[model samples]
Target: GIYLPVGLEKAAYNDGRTPIWNAEGCTTADIVYDDLRTTNGWDSSYKIDFSDPCAQKYIDSQARMFADWGYDFLKLDGVGPGSFKSGDNYDNVADVAAWQKAIATAGRPIHLELSWSLDYGHVEDWKKYSNGWRIDTDVECYCNTLVGWENSVDDRWDDAPAWTDHAGPGGWNDLDSLNVGNGEMDGLTNAERQSYATLWAIAKSPLYTGDDLTRLDSYGLSLLTNREVIAINQSSAPPAEPVTASDPQQVWAAKNPDGTYTVALFNLADAPASVTADWSTLGFQGKASVRDVWNREKLGTYRDRITQALPAHGSRLFTVTSHGTDLEWTGYEAEAGTLSGNASTAGCSACSDGRKVGNLYGGGKLTLDNVVVHKAGTYQVKVSYISGDARSALVSANDGGATSHKFASTGDWGTVNVVHVPVKLKAGANTITIDSGSDGYAPDIDRIDVQK
Candidate 1:
């Protein structure tokens, strides 16, 4: 989506970009006035009275024009129905609805995203008409450098959790641009950069790179491409929440559907300190193995708790899984299977073996060659997969008839879910296959667990 202002309001009064106000058919009836005129820090500006038919028609035309130009996403900034304390007095619900109607009329799947500290009171309306909405002020410092800590980035930590329930598959809480892909010019320290990326990823905010790609530094590039960290961002899981609301030293955690947890420890103080992740707070029991997501290193197994000495403003991400003494199920990792067509393996820090099979659709398939079972009978096999939208897959055993299973949204691509499928198996080694049928794409498979 291209970033474009709503044009209903301007940075400065009478800055000379008032198409809706100057249209031939439009009159004073289309403009909104009163205390809201200069209350928004602008000396003078005009607000579009969306209630007026002329104003609605004018916005409709603009939306249709943008859609016709092949824009699949639209970031409509400076929208209203916000807080009056922030100088937004008029409602823009009709305006947003007008754009929604216009896009549907144009027959395009353009994503309408509202921006600039949108009102939480009208959240349902925002969700109804848009794919995402900005929950806070801009993260940009608007200085010689891109951004600074005190300006707005830190504000998201407080503002984000308030809107967690509001974010999901189709709609999300946008935290503005992620400006950590460039060094020096990013106006952040190395530790700050990692913290910035970690928070945005775990919060499920859109990871829009707000930096110069051509001048990316090695550290910045690594932060942007870390597959393990990106998995947390892409997961269909909800935003991670503060474990104990402690300042200077904070811990956040999110439980994954496949009985795993993504944990982050932060030292937000000016000096180095110890940050700890408590298993009780994370809702886990027994000894568990931890993997450092950023460094991609297994940190060994621990019981009850794990602590790390972090540099000030530094953060750490880890995926924790319990190792219980049970023989109820046997695991088969997808990445170990034969990938055919477009099917391939990708690093998933949260999955077993740190990899999973993906792109299984349109001739893509995964074949597990030696899926041995003790007896020739029906076994409940748990398919662990990730998906952000509705999908289906075909699973078969020993070249038998395939069983089609429909999967519902798991929230995003990072979160994992398990579905049980009854597969008739032989007493010895048997083969299992997974692929998309004659329908839509298949979910990325993490692994399958056969009931023992």
Candidate 2:
């Protein structure tokens, strides 16, 4: 629904032309219970065991194809919970690992969202492998209809902790596609939709539109394009915790990095509602300008309090910035240093350590030897590389710590191969290391630039 015209065809060639099919070749079948069988509630037909190397290989290939097609976000469905297989079952875990390997090898930045719920303990483990995973059964439509004296409902959106903690930057706990523009009776009202949007934005959930975008009306379009309100959700900083739901009609606030706060006001009553927050509760003691992100209007400056008239089931969002100020450049870098694959001169210069031999493949020990910074700020890091051998390399930032991001060069590197990491800096004292694990042919490191 995000307008991904790029489908499976182009993904097979790594052509950057369309959305890669995230779920490829994985089998699926309806669940059937057999009472005559000795086995309890288990059914053999619904099993999907991916630990088998053959199955893993197939999944890996599909993931590679998606990466090649420029599809970086994946939702691996039909592989967990109700979809479990019999003995030797490593379906979810193995598939995730395989996809991670595939994405790394392809040199692409991918966000994987897994279907079905995982064990609570596996949260950190999954985060280490993929960007995000779903923690519940598919989210159904929000509205429900009644038949006779009984209500027949098919969709619901309930929050659970099992998948919540796993959410943040580079990773998220998906709650499924948003039902914003859907006019179905089970669909939420305008205010309710606003609440849902505000919550998802604050949660940093993947912004997938469940409604048919082509048929969106003016109101739906306005909700989707409210840049001010949307910016809070798109803030670079990880999402903040929601203030406690003390009152059903009230929403709370949290502080962000740039002296700004993300504010949400909810309306739970049956009709229209209004609420206000004092500056003291938001941790601000001085005057601040309030900008309504939804309507994109300047609400003037307030020294102590702010008020809003939220329609029933509706809410408002604001990015309260200190009044009277210019845009501040957080950080900047001039040279990302030289990159090379030769281990002997790895410490000398960037290119001396690696070389670009071909568009699809390179032969050498890949290394980002030196990086110089001209300004200080938080920087997002990216590196490109290529390797044919099944070798994994360690990407270390500021020298080796217990943990560092790892990359594997797939057979091709001409595609948009990359990995991302955020680094904080002072004037200019940062170094990155690329240690190629004992592969016969060294990997290749291309350009390295810091994004402000």
Candidate 3:
């Protein structure tokens, strides 16, 4: 977990004891698996056959030697089931286990990091044996620069979420490398450089820069050295959950233990974008104080929500703390309700619990079977939704007469807005059905909130 260089080494450099080239007069031939042939393809190099006992011995010995040599980290690259596909059913699980066992028996503590998109199916194994596992291919663009967004840096946005729960305390998820300490050589615009660091921090991925430390520009230095932003990464907080699941615009948030929340808004689109973060999705009610973490500026307090216009691929991180009389609100995620016809649950970054019920059109409907109320009365219900175009849907309580509600355009589908509707609820349990009728299409339903 410490970043100071204690020395780092890979497992493929061994010669006589590990995988040997198909050479004559090699004494360690018994350790090599004769059944299959695996090569590095660049030269006459062959992969280490981890299934052999002697090969494992060599790996274990190398680990112990590294530990004794004051090495603090070991990164095993080209691991299988996700990394190298030699087409011979090559799996490096045994090799990883050997290294893990070796490091444990070693006299010194060493960090074990697996690399190049290790299989998530064996994530439990990675979590158990290594300190971190890379979730995507190399972030490097492999061109003249260290990295480029379109090639691989942007790939993490689609891949990291699935591996969120797999990262934590003793072990972490490695997002390749943090390559933003340098300016143009980092191969990203100033906006993108910060956003890159933001995602790696909030996701709690190991933050080791790929850029040269001696050449950090002021903007790149600021992005890397901001204490408030670094605190979010080191807070050991769970990975931020996306409030809006769409691309081009995303809102991610995480709750801290000190009655505060960390929220990040991203604009991945080509043009400017207004990204909004709702208090309901952040699991709080009432006004809250917001501070821009990167700018180290205390923004004024706001009630219910806040919006920021960000440039292309830009991002903002904020810490929000509630300061008003806290109102208790009950939220019923639309995905938890029953779906009929084409209605179904889908991932939405701008919704409560990262999900929403959509496709409510032409016989599609969502029925909440257990909507409870203490007393019979009319109450305000806040329905959260996303709509680029104006739409309407019918809401019926207890299969009673339906009332149609119109939703105005919120500018785009990436933004979420709440509309309050007065609905009468009987004492105890009540059923509410949101239907789009035979031919009408309704806006996507994130969730509905009611004051308790």
Candidate 4:
């Protein structure tokens, strides 16, 4: 769509705010001006105007020609319908019917898959027209060095749970492609890549290999081919969600036919964390043996819980006939926010689960919701953060009072730094806030941890 704005569509304006109309004068209020542009850009040379009948005939012929060419899967990228309206705009609905009808005429079972993040409200339309759709954004994820809570592959993990009902049988929520095998494109470590694969498998997203298959490393291959994990995915069992998505201490569990569960405990933080999954919360009142699904080794049986220490972005995917308790108070479980700027809940490199990113100066603040303390006492609150220079932040717990914490130079953006302050809190849910105190830099905070 970037070759030239005028070529995509004729309009009084080509900026994102203006509306675009087809030849039929079919204009939509729900669609932003940008939504009306060409999908893949294909250099703007061979673009189809869905509004034209001649274009419809061409699309039909193209579909039949694709069938003739023996291509089974056709991913029609960036085509949404007027039915999937944004705001008040009636965005042009591409001539998808032409493709469907043409493929039918060609007598081929060509599976249509939509590209980009289709509007969630149009799931039924997707199921009717395509075999799968991407539920997340793109896969150009920068791994841990990135800071936003919602980005690329990890965002898929966050979104999969909510769309479980949309996935089953022929229809699926595609988690894009596997970014694990690529060394340069993705920034995930080996363990993180393994976690990514495990998550995709558990969520039952179609396993499209985004990497060069011929050059797949042994470890990547192993992660992709682990039969037990694949069985859990292919079992067609329901997708798993976080029992408690406590950053650095989240628990994701799926039920099995044998009355067992595949529970994955993820440490989505920068530092190491000992996270536990409660048996009761997991719907098991008693105990069950926990076995590592990847290694095929028994981690022994436990009565009421299982807790494991995990590194940054590390995960433990295992099966249990019976198991234990997990962590509490994850990232962005914010009960409140006085924060300005784009707060990133996405895990950063070597930072705790997520950070509140904003110009946290001049009374700019980020409040972490539901900070729990065991007893009413003084505790040291540590904020894992990022900054290229030194700064200071004011903190308060449950409005008990405010304390100031100072941060030193962290050398680089990815070099995680920490600052701590002592504050008193009650035994229940308390709100802890960080405010910029110094005049220098407002550091990117990864997470706030209060220790008694």
Candidate 5:
């Protein structure tokens, strides 16, 4: 996600630290069903008691007042299925539903956005209520030079394609903000800034200027006024999908209303380099015409593939006719899996490329296909997971055998950890399946990595 400067009035929640309702009629008082309360009860966040009727009144009244004040966007952050829980994540569906009721009935149309990286497993829920939400952390954290400028950008791009089909007209993915306009505070070079803006626009993420408009430089101004770039981003079509997710370079493309494909080729590495997008990988049979969207230059058609050299932290945006195939990753969503129970997802920030699976139930089953490898050998298979408590499941790699492994707890959902299992992969493609194997608690899985 990009960066955006946002102003919010959170002080009104000063009174929310106390108990949500009186303990008079509550039998679970000592049970501590309060979602926001910590062991010391010092959490400053104003979490509502969504189970209480009065809480509904408070939410509705606040929403109505905001609407009356002519506010059109309300971002409900820090509210998730699992808010401050011992598990990978907790659910706060009811909490968001309450606020939605208040806002939708407020006699005005308001855009509802959630924040702090909601999980992609709740796509249906998010689409049903909020207009947009964040999938990655804020970009301004890169302001510290110690962190390096490119690290932040890389983190956002790594997971950009996980939700390709999740955005559209009524709502969009929030890539965060346009931090590039702030000059030095942006901590990015001109090329990086333009790339950042291009990535956000191409992803169909909501655009918010995070820098001070008064002090914006010519470079930032030029980027904002780039009509061709804005046109691609604002297009009604769905966001682009990743053609190359992991690499020295990443490529994403989408079909436009005019049937031309808008492609973004990114140099995600430190050194300047050129790369190629094979025609087969891009889903095209023949050659095509290409136009560079950013530089407004028309590059003649080519056969086989499109090759462009980009400087470190730079990119090339092209609108091409006969855009080739759009290849999807062998991710959890694309695999064959049996998901029992609610078939919901829990997510974490450290997951590889924001990958998530739908099976969290004990009896659930997941089958992954097309796991490519170079040679047949034993590899250390690492599964990314986050859980409030220890969890385990039966996992078999390449149909060799099943072994139960416990996924350790990470203290919080945002903090992620991995467990290693030994698996043998044959040359070329492989498939692995997982089933409930222990204590019946299947940890939320983000992705799997096998290393020699």
Candidate 6:
């Protein structure tokens, strides 16, 4: 479990105090007294040095207290990365080792978790003594549009081999906690939240509840519980990699053990809307049963594919069980122009008039004209270009009869940029025009994938 500072514990003890920890104040009652030099005369620079009698006593005492409280896991924080001047070069490695020894000496079977980006190469040494440690910094409460927790995806946690055997039943890779259900979540619609949860489940990190559990709302509770959905996350098999995103609003499918699959349809748009996925591409031969995990409703069996309508910032989690023979190519495929390839770019500029935009890098852009719209619903157009580039691209889809939507590339190609447009279609004939913004550079044109 992740441990908050003693200051937070003190505030909780004192009927809660505002501004959390009073960083500037100095009192014996203040939780930071010893470390900040407000009450004790110990130098703040030597805060983490175990050789310091007061610091050692405080660390040892805290470990003992937590052990008594039945907390087998503890995350030691506030130990800054710099070296100690007064004590033996107080770095995280020494600090953690000291605490581990202290905890062992106290005769408690407590596990340790360290915070901040310490030298993970030393993880092998710490693992024998500690339980888990952070690969990044601490996560604050959800407030800003980009909550700190969302940044976890930017770094691949699975690439770290040291953490492999270290995680299981009682042990886990601490990827922080859920930022959803926190009323402060901004910039995310319900669909986006579902996507976030789905990603975490696939990552198989510890399911630490970061939201105020006592005040959980219905939607939040649904996300936390849905047994079938949660079961896939807890499964022992390696998770399926995400299908390529052709559009931000497209459905991403991951194969499950019993031949069924878990699908997450994300709404990259700010408003509530509905999107559709083609049945043929999903490998359904005829009709298949679909269950909506969130609503606990059966969407009935359908031949070929399933079409789901999602709310703004919300998504529909589905367990699609195939029936009868497998429809010729019934599983998801990356759409042509979207970030994930499972979308269709049939109506984009290049796909029109039988032209195709191919081979653009994941973060590149593409332009097509004379595209045809095969079906109609809500469609997400994504332009993936390289990461860290300051350049942006403008993409517009025109149906020739005056219906058009303009979407901008979200600077980073790996980041899915989305534009939602409502299209009305006849059974056989419709046209679309796509233009890459003339930003003095040719936008790398990946495939344009179209999802309903």
Q: Pick by TM-score: which candidate is best?
A: 3
How much is the lDDT of residue 387 in candidate 5?
55
Summarize candidate 3's per-residue lDDT along 116-208 as a digit string, tens digits: 677766778888888888878889989989998788887676666556666889888889889998868988898889889999999998888
**Model 5 TM-score, all chains together:** 0.64
How many clashes (backbone atoms < 3 Å, residues ≥3 apart in a chain or on different chains) does model 3 have?
A: 6
TM-scores for the candidates:
0.64, 0.54, 0.71, 0.59, 0.64, 0.48
Q: Model 1 clash pairs?
A: 13-44, 234-414, 235-414, 235-415, 236-411, 236-412, 236-415
Question: Highest lDDT, which number?
Answer: 1
Regions of model 2 farther than 4 Å from truth: 1-52, 67-70, 79-91, 106-110, 117-120, 142-165, 182-186, 322-452
Error of 4 at 321 (Å): 1.9
- Model 3 lDDT, residue 309, Cα: 95
The per-residue C-alpha lDDT of model 4 at residue 47 equals: 34
lDDT of 3: 0.75
Residue 112 displacement (Å), model 3: 0.7
Query: 1-452, model 4: which lDDT tens digit per residue?
Result: 01121113334223433333221333222222334544232223223455445455544555666777788888765444322324322222344455666667666788766656666666677777667777656666555532222366556554565466677788787877776765443556776787788888878887777676887777777887888878887885777655542234577787777778888888777677887776655644456788999887888888867889888777888888854333343333221355654333444546544433656666566777777777787654555676655566667878666755445445456656443345678888877777665453456777665542
| Cα displacement (Å) at residue 362, model 5 | 25
Query: lDDT of model 2 at residue 245?
Result: 22
Tens digit per residue, CA lDDT, model 1, 1-452: 56565535444334433445325765443544433343221222356555557666666666777777888989877676552334444456766787888777765788888877887767789999888898888899999889987688777766665566678888888999999987688999899899999999888888888899999999999999998898899987887766534356777778887878888888878789998776655544458899999999999999867889999788999998977433356799999899888899998876777889998888789999888878897665777787666577888999699877655445467666665555789998999999875445988999987755
- Of candidates 6 and 1, the better by TM-score: 1
The order by descending lDDT is 1, 3, 5, 4, 2, 6
What tens digits encode model 5's per-residue C-alpha lDDT throughout 1-452? Answer: 21111111234333344332333332222222344342111133334445556666655666777778788888766545422332222455655677678787887877888765666667578777778877666666644532235556666665555555668877777877767775566777777887888888889988878677898888888888889998888878778755542355766777788788888888867889886665544445468888888889999988767888889988888888874444333334312344455345544446665545645675676667777777897644556665555556777877588776645444445545544455678989888766664337666666665432
**Candidate 3 worst ten-residue window by lDDT:** 1-10
Candidate 1: where are CA atoms >4 Å away?
7-45, 83-88, 324-452
